[model samples]
Target: MPLVAPTTIQKVSGESQVEVPDLLAVEEPLEIRLGFGPTSNRQQKSVSVTMRTPGNDEELAMGFLFTEGIIHQPADIVSCRHCVQDAQKEGNVLRVELHPDVIVDWSRLERNTFTSSSCGLCGKATIEAVRALTPGPLASEFAVDAAILHSLAERVREAQLAFAYTGGIHAAALFDANGKLVLVREDIGRHNALDKLIGAAFWQNWLPMGQFGVFLSGRIGMELVQKSWMAGVPLLAAVGAPSSLAVQMAQEAQMTLAGFVRNERFNLYSEPARVRLAQMV
Candidate 1:
């Protein structure tokens, strides 16, 4: 939570001087470590590593595991602990231990290396590679009103404290069945904010958020859709537009996808039935 102070300087412009204040941004390195199988006896396997903001490290780690198809239920996570043994060597490396009998495909994980907060898949092959890893599409026919989708932008924006302060952070929020904001997180990177929110939900035993929806402050892309899909969230709303591939994936997954949510208006690219435009009037 450290920030550099803004500075003001004067420059000679002919016979005049000008001063301006510089904004200070906070950045920190967060390392995510996976411990699979049995937290009681402390038996675990290191899966993937990621660099992110220091806050919400545990949630980020748990959300990562769920999205990556490593574990299904929250009980599978034995414990997520921040390791300080090599504090000097590793800056804020979190070690997550999982329950026994947990199955992990190390071969698939090894194929991909470190993931950045911005882009979840750094060393993956192609879009098809991600598609292959995703679990089968969802089957439920969940629905929400278009008015709710449009209002999501304002609710999400109101909850973004970091963005309000620095005007330089992305937010990811979860809403309940009634379109009420339940949880929100902000970070310099969109994915990191999502991971932090997911990670926090995981620790709080809020996984399988089947009756809820996800809202993003940025554009809806494949990575965001994949993350929401893995979390068992059936609907995704964004303040911006979505990529073509994202729409395709949402259709395949049977998930409702909305973008360009602004001023009580939005575009439903897929699963229109899920959004009740008629209910608003």
Candidate 2:
């Protein structure tokens, strides 16, 4: 499906209104189904359904599964594709076939998928529920200069093709220590964008992204931090602010968390040592 759609809207400027053609970031529900169990007794189940801009869906499913602790490595997936059994479900339903050896504990996955893209961790009983799935504190020596961090926001903006048209999409970008962009993904949902980026990295064998920093175009939340932590990304920066719980989570995981990463300034919430600041003359 297309990432953006065309619509007509009234352009109100000063005192006059004129109808003009415009584009909007498309939003649609994507159902992610899981195929697991032994060869002799295969089973399929719908794991999650998230509203997102339609693109890079396979990567989104892969990223969601990995971050949700369903699969560990790229080898865990046999195949991931859109489900077409029902023509009506085409492009909106994805099925991920996992290696038979990959055991899935369904109990841990008991939650509604209807609101996952918005209310992350809504049904969860405790924060530890997700913290347990995430890897331990990051220990990599990866670091970036404050100046380089400041430049990332503009780089991300320049690469956001969909946002340029709709101005409603979010993005997740991965950059090397020198501030070079490695990958970028955009979606109507912030978490979905991160999932797509991580999904691409997971398939490309870029897990344990210790040498790279991930930047978000929106505010940092606890769920976003958890997802980045699951990918082993040491540094997480955002153009917006970080939630109190997100900062605490990053601190506990020993990850470097920075927010308000624009205008040559940013606030470091955790692991400040990883972001080198210039000394006074």
Number of the top lDDT candidate:
2
Predicted structure 1, TM vs. truth: 0.80
* Residue 194 displacement (Å), model 2: 0.6
Residue by residue across 35-132, what tens digits does model 1's lDDT show?
65544565545565554545676777777777776767788877787886895745467787777778777665554332323333432333445556
- Score every model by TM-score: 0.80, 0.93
- Candidate 2 TM-score versus the reference: 0.93
Q: What is the lDDT of residue 229 in candidate 2?
A: 87
List clashing residue pairs in candidate 2: none
The superposed Cα distance between candidate 1 and the true structure at residue 273, in angstroms, equals: 0.8
Q: Report the C-alpha lDDT of model 2 over 1-281, residue by residue, as the tens digit.
A: 99999999999999999999999999999999999999999999998989999999999999988887788899999999998898887899999999999999776566312222323464233345556776678999999889999899988999999999999999999999898999999999999999999999999998989999999999998789888988999999999998767876788789999999999889998999999888989
